[model samples]
Target: MSSETRNTANAPRPTASEPAPGSRPTATRRQVLAGSGAAAAIAFTGAFSELFAGTAAARGHGGYGPLVPDPDGLLDLPKGFRYRVLSREGDPLRSGEGEVPSNHDGMAAFAGRHGRVHLVRNHENRVTAKIGVPTVEGLTYDPAAKGGCTSLELDGRNKVLGERVAIAGTAVNCAGGPTPWRTWLTCEETEDRAGTNGYAKDHGFVFEVDGADPRRTGAVPLTAMGRFQHEAVAVDPGSGIVYETEDAFDRPFGLFYRFLPARPLGGTGSLRAGGALEAMRVPDLPDLSSVQETGARFDRVEWVPVPDPLAAGTPIRLQDFGPKGITHAQKLEGCYWGGSSVYFVSSFARSDEGSAADHYGQVWRYEPQKRRLTLVVIFGPDTDIQLPGESPDNICLAADGGLMVCEDGGGAQHVLGVTRRGEVYAMARGRQNIGTPEEPEWGEFAGVTFSPDGSTMYVNCYTPGTTFAVTGPWC
Candidate 1:
């Protein structure tokens, strides 16, 4: 997602008559919530009412909402809740290892013994001056700068039980989801050729890490998963199928993809052995050039398997599914598999015609069973929740059944919460000056997760590189 959409203030608004993608005759939102345990509880009576009512009340002030303050700056939340910092950039990796890498991104949490939780996090830095060069002992990549992954063990109090670096010397480390077998898939979001940095010889694929042993070896790139600007990944436990999103910011839009692992419940070693890669295409809408030109909207989502997964070595082109005959959209970032649906976000679209929908980013939901795609929410070129700027990066399901978005844009970045009913709220704002005069405010929040009990929420800042654990009455 890019912040350029916020600069255009006079774009034409979208009319109700415009055909919205993923538009169903009936309400699909309710069905998604009804199917999941956490969603059912929050989308229904108890928490749902509170979230909506609070949001409606908070909107009366300026465009900004009231702050859900945390005194320790650990975690900010609504009333009757608190938070603490679980980890920070530059913190010691473990007792004697190196320091925690900067630019922390996506993360996943699993149950640990003695009432502790295990977390595997990503550092989305291709190259940075502050972190020196990125390097791993055996891996042939830069060794001084940024771009790495880490695993941590924390107790109920959000105290660090143990921590260590899992992998390093990667590029543009971005968001990835969890697998059913209890492992974390850290995605590398760059297509820089093999020798550019030595880390990406056959890189730009998803890597699996054992949450239990972060220091264990055998971390290999899964080349079978395809190589493009990889963003986030979601796996279907029942089918052992993996869905991926591309974050291409250039002219041609990125794509949504899926990989069916050759072997089910395969070891956490690599993605090379099994499965086939497939790009999603809309069967109904074959041509998208006219749609991109006229700014029309349509719902077209169908999955087509790639005949050869190895074809990833070449520049992979995605089929267009937009209305008016279809033109590619840019940067297909932020994705998650939940409530029997694949949810994804498109950062921005260039609009020579000045269409509102073009400048605004969109949240799309794909129902595999129905073989359909729908646009659930649209954020305009502004700072408000509904009118969010471009660059909607990573997303996670809140304890209250809403969506938590990390705004990776300029001008007062924030962590936004969007409800199931399509309402948006600012859960937290970027702190300008934490404690230093020269250090700028920490923005670009990525990687969000909640404890299994749903009592605590964890968030990470990609720039200054910080992680905080917030606890509240989210449910």
Candidate 2:
């Protein structure tokens, strides 16, 4: 069932809104988070409670002028931002639940009991890998599964206080979003068949991990949200609408989606409470992906109901319900909610990949109130994703409302930052010798997020997976 308008006249909204694009293609921290209506509906909450207590944009004050190369050669920051390794794939945990799993991807930070910050992180390992991460027999739904999430408790000083397996028995637990009710929505990135590839049940779905104890949630799939190659999600707190993306890389490109909760008007406001799923449509453009310019805004977008979220064997764009009615994009990844607008990335759409659009990466902004999607920035092939960046994956909004994008394209990886004015800067670079040249620090960056207080930033390296807590001058 599609969601109906709610009476959240008293509900809390995000403190701001994205700067309306026009002659001004640029954005400001205030324009990205502070405003009214759709702008007021974001932030950490459950049953409606503010998670962040500050009115300042998360950006470090006026922003650290420029980055200074790290003498250590691991990460580079603008003079003040510094990071510390928090946990690694084989690090021992407080519960003795084995070492932290590899392929760290999507993650979120939460305000925990007794003023600690809790992190629910995903491990993208699959069954094929000989991973030792175990499933909580009683709390897991798929015993053969090797991918899941872990939890870390950190003190105010950016020190890890404890760690443990948060949830297990799932596959490809990639990028996920934090819910208002204090939970993590870990998304499975594969559409693996249940009976094939050493599997017993379906693999592609979203699972909820409780901020308090992610282990207990188990393998329950939010079937209503669709079972495709999900990349990331951004939830609208005011409307209980979930914005989704797909990571399919071939011909029939991926389609963007929205899940309307069934409980609000009748269904509850959660994936557990099944809801109606829909796709994006751009009426004026025949092929939305064919665009060639940046800073272009397209208004008059609408949503069409998707026929079968789970049984649809093809990427939703190739389904009967979509081709003619919906718009398609390639490698639609990282998506974040800010200033009443949804920011999404098309890591790289290319003609050789059987895509009509050929670009290294794309950043788009969707305004809920105006029902429009604007191309905020487009990176060309010359951007050369080999090292220092390309194919921006998981994303987090900085304190100043700029973007902290995790690079997943090619060569060595790094975390790149984008100013609200559309300038991209190198925030962190990945490096390692690993006793060999072929495997010299090739893991991509993912799980970009910030502490609720904006005092710290967190990110992950996808291989020999590791998580780091960064603290420094961020305006």
Candidate 3:
């Protein structure tokens, strides 16, 4: 069961509950945000202008350390780290499973037998697959919905053992969260309703998939979690609450929400049973501009009950909470459950995206314990979106308590790292071009995550999709 020799016609598929080293660890919301981690989050420069001393459009040099360009030009990693292309957009499978799907977006790593791991990978496909992971009968909801997830096993050396479709026939499976109960929550990055986008049913929703499920359970949409252009989710183990991020790029902006499950701590399949979806509202913050000032801190924030969880026509942002001050972000994308808080990335606020106020990017830390959300690591206009380490998207916590952020902004994409000391570094930079002279590969990196034991890191190249696994003597 090796990556290179995976062309066997009848290779045994790896089980989701396949035993491994140890289950991934979890920390309480308070412990994650209490001391040093909280201080480090605040100092990351969410005060856009003050941190960089200017704007992203005008800024100079930034990045934790120097990126030694890879000789192959596919990725520029720091000195000690190295990466391997685990799966390509169109590689044929070894077990006759199917070709690796394109549009790789969100992903999670679950333990496998003998120190191995299972990566539940998502594809952000909007239309029917011209060419991608096909619809599996038992796993598909709508044949026309070309988006879904694929599960693959990785062994000790970080090589693919086998690949198979986990969930099938959904739409725009963007980014999702890894549940404490050992499952992946796949999110849809679309608001295109059923009849409008040629979809048989409403599109925006979240589906859960267990990597160890020896069988596919089909598409299970957790409607109670709300319906909109969902980007990602971060779970709070202590309280069965699921924090969700919306990727609405409109001027009105996207809302940060949390779903309170009706069935407390019901684990993976809990949301579908029912829950109360609520949007975040800060006391004094009305517009998105209030946080654009950099180093802006909003304490004592509360959740506003969403008027309509299923935002069919008028999204939750425009519903009742709009006037009540539901704080909005330019484009909320990737979010991770940081030990004591939830760390989320707000992809640059640009006027082009209908935003009056624009920024390179901003990272925020939401401390549920204190009812506070702090603005951290803000890039001004001077910051270079083209250079690397700007406009961050999908994020994951490192074993060392640092943050791994996928650069989704512009120029050459990179996997950026943020230390507890509030320092930002280029962990890995994309090199290979997926497009031709007319459209050379300029894809942003997504699905940044680490293996359970923290020996390896996995990330995705969004366009002409591809996934890479990097191993190194992590700092």
- TM-score of every candidate: 0.76, 0.83, 0.83
Per-residue accuracy of model 2 over 1-475 as CA lDDT, tens digit each: 0111111101222122334332222232121211111111111101100111122333432234445555554555555566777887766677787767777889999998777999889888787754645777555757778888888888777667777777787888878787666778888888887786777888788887875665456657788899888889888766767889988756677888888777522222346778788888766454546875554566566777787788556655567764455678888898877767777888887787777867767777787777767776655434333444357688887765666788786665667665543344566666643336655546778898988887888988777677877777566
Give the residue spans of candidate 1 off by over 4 A.
Answer: 1-65, 68-76, 132-146, 198-200, 215-217, 266-272, 283-300, 307-313, 318-327, 352-357, 381-390, 433-442
TM-score of decoy 3: 0.83
How high is the lDDT of residue 385 in model 3? 41
CA error at residue 192 for candidate 2, angstroms = 1.0
**Which digits, one per residue and each the tens of the lDDT, describe model 1 over residues 212-295?**
765453356677887777899887655667889877656455668878676756556535565677777654443222232211
On lDDT, the leading prediction is 3
RMSD of each: 10.1, 10.2, 10.6
What's the candidate order when arranged by decreasing lDDT? 3, 2, 1
Q: What is the Cα-based lDDT of residue 378 in candidate 2?
A: 59
Model 3, residue 424: displacement in angstroms? 2.2
Model 3, C-alpha of 434: deviation from truth (Å): 3.2
Backbone clash count, each prediction separately: 27, 28, 32
Count backbone overlaps in model 1: 27
